[model samples]
Target: MKDAEKLAAFCATIADERKADNIVQLKLADISTVTDFFILCTANSEPHLRAIADTIVRDAREKLKVRPRKVDGKPASHWIIIDYTNVLIHIMTNEMRELYQLESLWGDAPTVSAIKTLRKKTPA
Candidate 1:
């Protein structure tokens, strides 16, 4: 897979490991300049957001050798954004996700199916 797809899939796995809900990956390369993909997931609370964000950082650094160019928002906030240049990750509470409706905003971008489906197709 390409770097963008690899990065997005990796991030999605990290989010799933942390019990993030409604994970969605959007292919934004064709339509946006900001990033190639957006990995969005919903967290249950601030601590849950922290767990997801912290593990993404730790695992990406220790395992993937990749780090976010920039990170925005905080665990206390409703949303947290991790920017990896080619891929962007958003972890948010249900309320914030509903308010922003990023999936709706980027409706034109093609949506990648659940990561679990992708994992299942690949042999362990």
Candidate 2:
């Protein structure tokens, strides 16, 4: 896998570890210039959102020597976005996720799998 795709899978695994719900990765390379992959998951609450965000940042930096170029939205906002140039992560509350309906909005984008498999191969 490309580094971006591997990073996406890593972020997805981090979300899963933090108990984020409905995790999904949308491959946007063919359709968008904004980013390569969108790793999205739903957080249960403000604290949960913060925890997931923190873990991703810390783990990515420590494990992969990677960091997001920019991070948008606050933990309390219930919808935070972490942009890593090649990959973008969306951590949202259930309500915000439902409201945005990103999956439908990006219906043409293909969902990327193998994250679960990747998680198994990589150490935490």
Q: Write the per-residue lDDT of candidate 1 for residues 28-88, one digit (tens) a residue.
A: 9999998899999998899989889989988998988998999999988889999999999
lDDT of 2 by residue, 8-124 (tens): 989999898887888999999999988899988888889989999999999999999998999899987899999999998999998999999988988889998633321223576
Error of 2 at 50 (Å): 0.3
- Local error of candidate 1 at 96, Å? 0.1
Between which residue pairs do clashes occur in model 2?
Answer: none
Q: How high is the CA lDDT of each candidate model?
A: 0.88, 0.88
Which residue runs of candidate 2 sit more than 4 Å off their true CA positions? 114-124
Clashing pairs in 1: none
Model 1, poorest ten-residue lDDT window? 113-122
Give the CA lDDT, 0 to 100, for residue 33 in model 1: 91
Displacement of residue 1 (Cα, Å) in model 2 is 7.3
